[model samples]
Target: MAKERALRRAAREAEAAKQRARRARIVARRQRRRALLTRLMPRRRRTGRLLVRRSRGQRAGIAVVTLVLLALVWFLVDDIALRLVLTLLGLLCLPALVVVALGRRTS
Candidate 1:
């Protein structure tokens, strides 16, 4: 009975060790895959502050309007130099324009 008990205990211990090793391998493979994926397609870190404090919809609206205006300028303007200047000016003035246009009206 004593010998049989010792043999059973050793068998259980060996099975447990094999399970531990299998889990370690799985974990290592997952880690390696994650590392490779991260290296290949790294996520962009949002470290810098957004210039405009607006909701996603608001920002999208502003971008659409800006693009429309630029497109109009591009199509309507005959001179390349004038078109370039206007586009640059529009972009430069966008922040101030947004603030003024969307500012709270004090009654």
Candidate 2:
């Protein structure tokens, strides 16, 4: 019975080692693929200026609110030119508006 138990334990350990090796190979393959893709892709130059620092939640909330407001303007407004003008002005003033709304950081 003891000899049988020993063999079973050895088998389990061997299987675990095999699984670990398999996972390592998978990780290495993923890393290689990522590296190759990154090399192939052209690097994007960040030409835009930093507007404001906001948390992810804040950014998401702003996006949702902006979408809702745009939708309202699209449905409610009669003139297409007026809607386009409003959208352009809103986008241009967004950074300043956010900074004003958020106020200065204490820390």
The most accurate candidate by lDDT is: 1
What TM-score does each of the candidates earn? 0.48, 0.47
Candidate 1, residues 18-45, lDDT tens digits: the string is 9999999999999999999999996876
What tens digits encode model 2's per-residue C-alpha lDDT throughout 1-107? 99999999999999999999999999999999999999999997664645345666788888988888888888999999999998888888887887798765642
Best by TM-score, which number? 1
**10 residues in a row with least lDDT, candidate 1:** 45-54
Task: Summing lDDT over every window of 10 consecutive residues in candidate 2, give the lowest-scoring window.
Answer: 46-55
Candidate 1 Cα errors over 4 Å, as ranges: 1-52, 104-107
Candidate 2 Cα errors over 4 Å, as ranges? 1-52
Tell me the whole-model lDDT of each prediction, alpha carbons only: 0.90, 0.85
Q: How many angstroms is residue 13 displaced in model 1 relative to the true structure, after the best TM-score fit?
A: 52
